[model samples]
Target chain A: MSLINIFSDYTLRTVALGSALLGAISGVIGTYTVLRKQSLVGDAVSHAALPGIGIAFLLTGSKNIEWLLLGAFISGWLSLYIVNSIIKNSKVKYDSALGMILSVFFGLGLVILTYIQKIPDSNQAGLEGFLFGQASTLLKRDVIVMSIVGGAIIIIIALLWKEFKLLSFDPEFCQVSGFPKEKLDLILTTLIVIAIVTGLQTVGVVLMSDMIIAPAVSARQWTDKLSVMVILSSIFGGLSGVIGTIISSSTRNLPTGPVIVVIISAISIISLFIAPGRGIIWRRMRDKKNKKRLNRNIILNSIYNLNIEGNRIQGYSLEDLSISKGDFNFPINTIEKELEKLETLDLVKGKDEKWYITEKGINEIEDFRGRLEE
Target chain B: MNVQIEIQLIAIVVALACSTLGVFLILRKMAMMADAIGHTILFGIVVAFFITHDLNSPLLIIGAALTGTLTVFLVESINKTKLVSEDSSIGLIFPLLFSIGVILISLYAGDVHLDTDAVLLGEIAFAPFNRFVVNGVDIGPSSLYIMGAILIMNIVYVSVFYKELKISTFDPNLAMALGISPGIMHYSLMTLVSLTAVGAFDAVGAILVVAFMVGPPTAAYLLTDDLKDMIFLSGIIGTISVVLGYWTARIFDVAIAGMMAVMVGAIFLLIFLFAPDRGLLSIMRRKKRQKYDFAQISFLMHVINHEGAKDEREELGINTIHEHLGWNKEFVKDIFNNLYKSNLVYIEDDIIRITDKGRDLAISNAEEIVNGI
Candidate 1:
């Protein structure tokens, strides 16, 4: 489909809208989850929800999205509760608890799914979609349900913004200030569970975590403030959702969830490399420039020091400068190149193959020393 | 052997291999790295498959090990940059690689023998049929042998490097000071984890391999403090889960690997709730007993301090003593009765008094508390 056809196509529109809603909600909640250093919780919760979906189908014997997701929400929350209890009560570490619960819960889900397949007249055709999500199968009603849930989550986040912020940054301070830390934590966790469940239909179990973590991580590279990070993260998430849905829908045999994951991963990688301030490439460039400037200053200062030692306005050959002085070693070509650049800056004067420090060069050396002393 | 026995053997071997290394993983706090490696190795297998065009090629194992090490390298490098936290780095890298693998499978490998469902939810029921043929005779299930070799390899690795792994896990700086490189230990262990994961993947799928790797060890951690006991206990737990899960899956006609993972979780839950020293119930019971003992000590100390005071009558009166101690009347009465039964305190002229035993205990406790011991 072309760009305009994406909006004009009914199935594409529904999938895109549902995916965007899922992405935005997860993005907003993921900011807090990532900030709280619980990024992998989404992975565990999503995996755990698989069993819930199967159990829900078994009990209700229908493919109602609402019932299925409610089942997902409950079980996902239960897994998180179990993980926290295990961490708090035993010698088991957090990652072990997460990995254990995630895999075991998913195993149970698979068992239930296989059992469902065995049942006569079960109509289990669509259940496998939860494994590797089938966004192309999303209908109008699913999008409606997603929006309603997504809207409520956004509103809840807005109402509890201050509490969530305090809880994320400093739970101890929030608790000391008479806030119910446990209850607030439960609320935040529940909100996160809801977000993950809502996105499960779009992204599935295995890749749902990237939806939660990638956008927030990308947005974090661009900004330090919580609000900006949250907003930028949601925008990045929503755009990836729409773009991924479009790409997957246009292609043959491309699963929407993984494609969406690929898009978000690309965005995260690009943000890591190119975002200002914290970007890796920018930091590297800045470091390189600083090193170059430092080298130039060292060469200038050395010329001034050699002239002072000789107690005469004498020039030094490139050979003299290339020799290691006080552990400062530079290649002969590097020394020559730096001298030429310094001469252009009027800091040094080069005649033939020899170099002499100018009056400005001496003043610059004195200024650098004075600054260093202060 | 029968298919049932062969399948169970494969599972048992897979579990043993995973749980043994899992002990080190949890100790080094890299259990989730196992989860990451489990997923990303699929990308490696897919790439290796494309090169060899054969599913049974040994090069796949090398590719998986390399990919697992690469995942660790990338995560650490990203973490070293301080751009993202460690968890986020893990969450970021694996899914991307796994997605590429999934997409590749869907696109080009569609007609191949590779199945995504088999990769994610391995059908161990079919594992027994993949016989390892030697000359003209069959030598049991191929996965059983593969997993058996991997299990022995894990046992040998752990035993050979026990001291190094222990020192590095508990104290990396000390390991470094002792001239053992923790980085080498870390990457080698990661390589081993990937190897075990790939070997187990055919029998238990990608995600359930994590259950095998993490579940038993976590349960064993609750049962013991010694590393040797932990390793032994986790292996035992893994074996029990494999046997029980196989039988249960047979009875219900369900997915065997899934049932095995569930069994692992259930065993871990049981140990978490009922283990002798570290169980939740025992910990709570210990806290309750400590509370009562602390209360009794405070009661004895209070009576001893006021035994010969100017306001002894006002402070030591039975009705007033509860008020002086800032405790409710009923709780104070219960504490006094318990202390009286223990012969630590006595009632004289309706005033509380401390016996010599109580006085001695109170002085020692006070000194210990004041000394911050």
Candidate 2:
């Protein structure tokens, strides 16, 4: 089927739009988490949201999405607060505290969920979806709620962009500037909680961290500027959502959460390998060039030292240099290759099987030595 | 034995093992890696099943080990890039592996007994049903034995390598300088963590495995400063949590694993508030006590100075004491009451007199203050 046909489908469109909104906001909010080195904080808060959801259902006696989400928001916020408190008040480190809150809250949530399931008249048919996500079962009303919540989160993030940037980049500077750092941190965390809770239904608890991390990681490979990274990350996140929805919709019995995770992971893997400057491929190429230049200089230095020792620059072979500069560990082929480059650069002359360093090579070596000293 | 007894035994063993290993993880600042390994073991099981076409293959352990190492390697590799921090690297790798397992389950074997739900919410109550029978004799619960052996392995590993583990955990550079390979120790520990996590997860589930790994050790951390004491205390704390958790589960008839996790958290909570020196209440109490002690000493010094002064009008009366000390009436009264109870002061009517002990304390405090100690 054509792309138009897929977008035209009502259920698919709603699911796609909902997930896209979730992805974009999480991606944007996730930048702060990634930059501030609180990436696992997202993971912790999302897991902590589970119990809040279960408790909300038990207390309300209804599985209303709004009440459930409210419960998750409160739970996530409380977990963040607990993590902060543990770090501040005790000797426990940050990661352990995050892990402690995450696992405990999730365990409590499980207990509550099991308890709710045992109740006779409970309408908990879809509550378990929050564990691994059941985006395929999303209703139009659910999509509407997600859009509203996610939209508000993104708008708030946009409004507080400068403060968020300053907070993420230099919290000490923010404090020195008397910027209400604690309040800003609370606001940022609350926004992350809202984003996590909203996305919980679509991607579930286990895969939600991927939704937050993958887009930001992918965008980071392509840019250094925070503004550009933010824009790119959101686009990557939104694109992954749309792509994952389309693929899952076309496939039979495929869930959306894992599919979305897979799609975003692919985007990040590609970005890691092939993006400019920061990419593995580009970096490797630059490293290779630098190594070659260093090798050429080393060979020239070896020849210069040999010339000074015996004034014999005409009959140097690869074996001679290899034995004299054994620390270089240069193989025969590598020595020959560097020598060939030096010959091409008119810094060396080769005749028969021996290589001679020209006056240009001597001058080049002197210039390199002078620059090294300075 | 009954399933309840079997589950309790399994819980104790798993908790002991996880909490023991957790001390190193916490010290190494890699506690979240336990959470990552717990989730990614599902991928290991899935791939093992796919490769062997047998869900119960023992080779699943190898797959688990491979993927667990992969997780550690990936997190370290990402962190080495300096693009992301250690926690971000953990966050980056965990979900990707777990999601792949989910995708595999959904695409190929959703109909089979291989389940994500089972992985997430393992049933300790049903552990006895999956018993190991040898030669027509039931060898009790398989989870019990598996977890028991794992518990022993963890004990042996930590004991045999205690010095190495301690050196590496506390100061890797020192370990390296002393000819110990911190890298090798690290990978070995990660391997052990993966093995213990998978075995424990099969009995108590992933979330509870994390709780046991982190919660008890953290509580122990808050309670002590010595490494050996931390390990010993974590085991004791974990055992206490399991015993209490088992009773709570029975009383409520809730999920045993979840209840155990909650109980572990509760124990940590209590310790966080009441662990003598490092706890919240104790710290606050110490601060308050320090303030009161400082005030009492200052009052003693003031009285000594007043008596030494040439002005006879500076008498040691309650009203004068309050005014001279700049303390409120209630605070002054409390200080005076404490001083009199300790015999550091003699009170006759409205006048206060410093005792010999009080004079000595004031002189020593003056010495300390003058020396700027």
TM-score of chain A of 1: 0.94
Tell me, what's the RMSD of every candidate?
2.1, 3.7
Q: Give candidate 1's fnat, 2 decimals.
A: 0.92
Question: CA lDDT of A142 in candidate 2?
Answer: 83
Root mean square deviation (Cα) for candidate 1: 2.1
- The CAPRI classification for model 2 reads as medium
Chain B TM-score by candidate, in order shown: 0.95, 0.88
Residue range A1-374, candidate 1, lDDT tens digits: 77796879988988999888888888999999999999999999999999999999999998999999999999999999999988898767899899999999999999999999999999999899898788888989999998898889889989999999999999999999999999999999999999999899888989999999999999999999999999999998999999999999888998999999999999999999999988999999999999999999888878877887885567899888777375688988998898899999999998877788888988998999899899
Best by lDDT: 1
Candidate 2 chain B lowest-lDDT run of ten: B306-315
Segments of candidate 2 deviating more than 4 angstroms: A300-336, A346-370, B52-56, B297-363, B366-373
User: Candidate 2, after superposition: displacement of residue B10 in Å?
Assistant: 2.4
Clash count, candidate 1: 0
lDDT of 2 by residue, B134-185 (tens): 9999988777787888889999999999999999999999999999999999
lDDT digits (tens) for residues A1-374 of candidate 2: 44795567888888888788778888888877888877887899889999899989989988778999999999999999999988998879998998888999999988888888889878788999999988877778888898787778778888988889999999999999989999999898888888888899989987897788888888988998999998899899988888888888887868899889889989988988899998888988999999889999999889888887865745687888888753687888888898999999999888888878889998999999999999
